[model samples]
Target chain A: MRRRASLVLLALAVFFAALSPLVRWYAFPRLAKIPPSQYQDMVLEAKNATLLDYTTMKSKKVPEVSIVQTLKGNVAAAGKVRERTGRDVVVWDTLSYVADDKGRMVSRIPERYVFDAHSQEPVHAGGEHVDGDPVRRRGIEYKWPFGTEKRDYEYFDFQTRTSAPIHYKGTRTVHGLETYYFEQTIPWTKVKVPKKLPLGATPETVEQLGLERWYTTKRMFWVEPVTGAPVDGQEIHEEEMRWTDKPGKKPLTAFAGHVRMRPDYQKATVDLVSSQRRLVLTLTTYLPWGSLALGGLLLVGSLTLEARTRTRGRPPGAGGPPVSSAAPGDPARARRPSPAPGGSGGMAPGAVGAFTGAFLKLLPGRRPPDQLTPAARVPSCARWVRPLRDPPAKGAWDSGRATRPAHPGSPPPRTTRDRR
Target chain B: MRALLAAAAGLAAALALVLAVTATGAPPGETSKKPLHTTVPAHP
Candidate 1:
């Protein structure tokens, strides 16, 4: 009985141990991909900023300028891309809008970013990022990949339409989360005016008016490593319009600010990402290792049980099946083990009684050792093995062992001389 | 007594197996918050 149980435990341990890597490397990538239908938004504020009043064509100092950024996943677009690329994809329709304290419109940039749902690497599909200018995007943007490393990452800029290495500056505890701090500096670069300008003015027309846009920024991100989600972010952003045709024209400050996530938004982001971090760790780290540990413990338990059973289930001269343990014409002796076919046996030496069904080779699964006669009970103290044969029925007359004909399935015969 | 021990051992194995498989499930919830930002339509 004990040996059968140990075998069952050994099989279960191997099963769990084998499942560990499959959980980490296989299931995590497939299940944890960015949801293609997810939609998220954040609010950033820049205090005491400068904005160019287009009506007056002059730079004015404003009390605050706010940027509202929204990312809405395009399920249909991702589905279309996933079919061809054979990879899970996410298409994000992004909108960035700037406004003054009085809620006057400043500038708006709409973008379509496509990327691998698992790795976050940009996928250049048709008509991507922007219209007319199909800027081939590269590197990390908006968010990082899960299990982010403590090394530099190639970061992408939507405005410059280029990729640069963002250096990891060390670790930080932001909002009580241990995070990786990354920063990137972009130098001044001349850029195009918004295609969707107010008053229906075109970029060509704006260029004809000698108004050119120049921009530069220093970006910072604090990302939770497990979820690869940004808990806090900031950008020291500056933009100004200069004259290309006329050198003496006074340059207009288009926008300038040290923009940061709103305090409430930061708190919400931390709360949201913190929960996600735990889940990601569960699949990629915790579950795999936990299963492996449990498997190891089970393995030890099984081996110990087998050792103890072997030491205690065998009596003197019981290393092998006892001769004449079962008669040849006995129905129990003719029984074969399930699954492991062609085994003709009534009982195993150590496994005197057990389920002994499929794939287990013991038989005559009956009778507890405590009910056995003293000679039969000698070997069952350490191992809780039921005996192979049952006690004879009460008052039933049994022939003595000298006849060599009494069935062993019955208890040993009484020695009292019956002169009947 | 032996039957009870077998039952307890089976239960523990099932519980461990369930935990390992359930950990691979997808995270279903999403976040979408539109803050109080007033502005004219972005396009003309």
Candidate 2:
């Protein structure tokens, strides 16, 4: 028995020794990609994925969201606004549900509206933020009412190379729905700001001011407890910078709540709450970025995996095929005759063409790799390409730019939301 | 002594397999790090 136990211990050590590096390499990178803690929570809730059992020290105010589908085949949205103070719990009753085409659901439309106080009136000329550039505080203001509609994509476009962490907090039964409590957090450092800044602002001042204005948005999302999809969730915006003289009294933070109903997935109702009153907007359009994002992720992942395969230590079967040489007689012809069907190695025309394309891409003076290599491969993690032994001078280089260039699917800065 | 050594090696092999599986397994709850490029939409 003693011998057996000793063997077990030795095995455990060896097991960990071999496995630790793998974990550190693959698993560790994931930690960096996770979203901030607060955002993770809210994301899980919205995905209806799961819910975490969190201590509701204070319920605060619950903003009511009404989901609805609009005529343009887009998921249009409008919601009320609300904010509250202290531990005071406010009872809010707002009927918000998604509008469906009789009984069907559509989930991918990119514009939404935020309504005024309680009435259907939109606060800004455009219900949503203006589309093109992010607004700099005290910067050039768009026309009246339109100014109220803030364009976020300019400053908040999704990072194609980063991922937020999802945590399963716990489980709960809400209105007969068994939901899993999953949460995530998005750090302020990862936030993308506008390229240009307001007048009189230094780069440092711009970042500092941006952080101050947006940092306190602690978002707690609740997924469908069961399905891990969005059901309902809330956001608590606290001011990063505090005003003196009024200790404990920070500026009013916006509280927004959302929920998706049956029929159409595009339409949603949102609740925006303030200290004074609660407003609910219905038939708001929801821009479905989830599918678009997933597609981008798959493409990026396949590329990373291919890079890893190339860089990883060769497995036994790798490099087994005989190397081929080109013929000196003709530039385009192979020196040796093509391998026969029963030959040791032969690739079909299609497969050969694909391999040739990839191999040619790695050559210098060609376009850089469409997908950038992971941080590890980049030498020294250079601003664009890291310091590495062999930096590809030619090919498409991964600049590792903080924000990626815009894509077609991204919504326009100004959309019908403005007319609303 | 040789039997003991052989037993130890066998045990080590088994434990290594277990550890490999655990390490490769998906993270508990939600994934801590999602693969880069996976997009998460903002909730309404």
Candidate 3:
């Protein structure tokens, strides 16, 4: 019965151990989900640009462009799972307003994003269908395993309303925690310039000021593996314009500056990542493996005890027929005696009985010596009677037996049976 | 031995449930109060 219980325990341990990977895949991603009614305010600045006067054809002092943007968003669960996709949809709305250095309103943009609840990838954004596997959503990537290499991801750009390929650049330590590094670079493209330039120039003069090309924009993110949160981010936006006919001329510096996430945000992200990582490590790695090891040991111990019990229960003289005690030339036969109940020329029956009684007492569910019946004690006594029945040869004592006497006062050998 | 193994299995199951429920119900990390910044060099 005890052995059966041990086997059941071992099976349960194996089951739990197998659950580790499932927790990592399903539970870990959910940690990165953005909740409803979340609000964030970010301040951005466009640094020193040449204040150009198109009417006077002269350059004034440089001016700074400052922007304060507020983002308020919410996520809601879909009522039913969509067709062709067994997962429910998650709807997200982010309303943002931007203001300049003088507190004048710049732009108010309302964006909508829809994603599959399971994959956390954008299905729709900005009233347009975005079809592709998403590498990231809301500044967080979904599922990144350790040792991941130069994998390419299709990233959706909210500003451009398009998807672009981003590359993983391996891992880096951020705030003392290892993180996956990913980068996206948008090349220079000829884009129609916005009506308002940072330096207070009109659209026609802006064209003449050489600010027509969208020079380059680079984005980098340091993402925590367990939670997939971006602990730190860097964005570099650059632009230059040229005359409609002049292609090779020195291009004027339209805008040049770098935007970085605030220290407070990074710190918060780091704390979240650390907590999530620790939880994952304990649940998925330590606990499962620990249970398996301990359960395995217990199973082995139970089996070993059962085998010993069977060996000890064997009848005396079962190994071979009884030999004559008077055989003079056969010292082996003379020294050994049949281990049968009431046998003679062997160890004392009382001593053998006491030793077997003590051994069985150590096992779980077995009666102590004082409670066992004489009939029950006979089999145990027969097990050890042979050694005591035969007296040792004269020279046997001289060899080592007398000198290496067993410790009389020592306690019985410890056994796992007591653990039950 | 049986009790210990049972306890371990119970612990793992409980932890998995807690994590799954928390992930589904609880909010993520709060946004920072500070705002992002980009400074144009004065001499640029």
Top candidate when judged by lDDT against the true structure = 1
Off by over 4 Å in 2: A1-162, A187-212, A225-228, A239-420, B1-44
Question: Model 1 — TM-score against the truth?
Answer: 0.72
**For candidate 3, what is the lDDT?**
0.48
- lDDT for model 2 comes to 0.28
TM-scores of the candidates are 0.72, 0.20, 0.53
Task: Note the Cα lDDT for every prediction shown.
Answer: 0.68, 0.28, 0.48
Clashes of 1: 0
Candidate 3 error regions (>4 Å): A4-8, A21-73, A77-85, A95-109, A124-150, A191-215, A240-254, A280-298, A301-420, B1-44
lDDT of 2 by residue, A70-182 (tens): 21111112111222221111111111122121222211122232332112223332334322322212211101111112121111212111333345566655444444444
Name the candidate, 1 or 2, with the larger lDDT value: 1
Docking class of 3: incorrect
* Docking level for model 1: incorrect
Candidate 3 scores a chain A TM-score of 0.54
lDDT of 3 by residue, A15-42 (tens): 4544444445545455434443345444
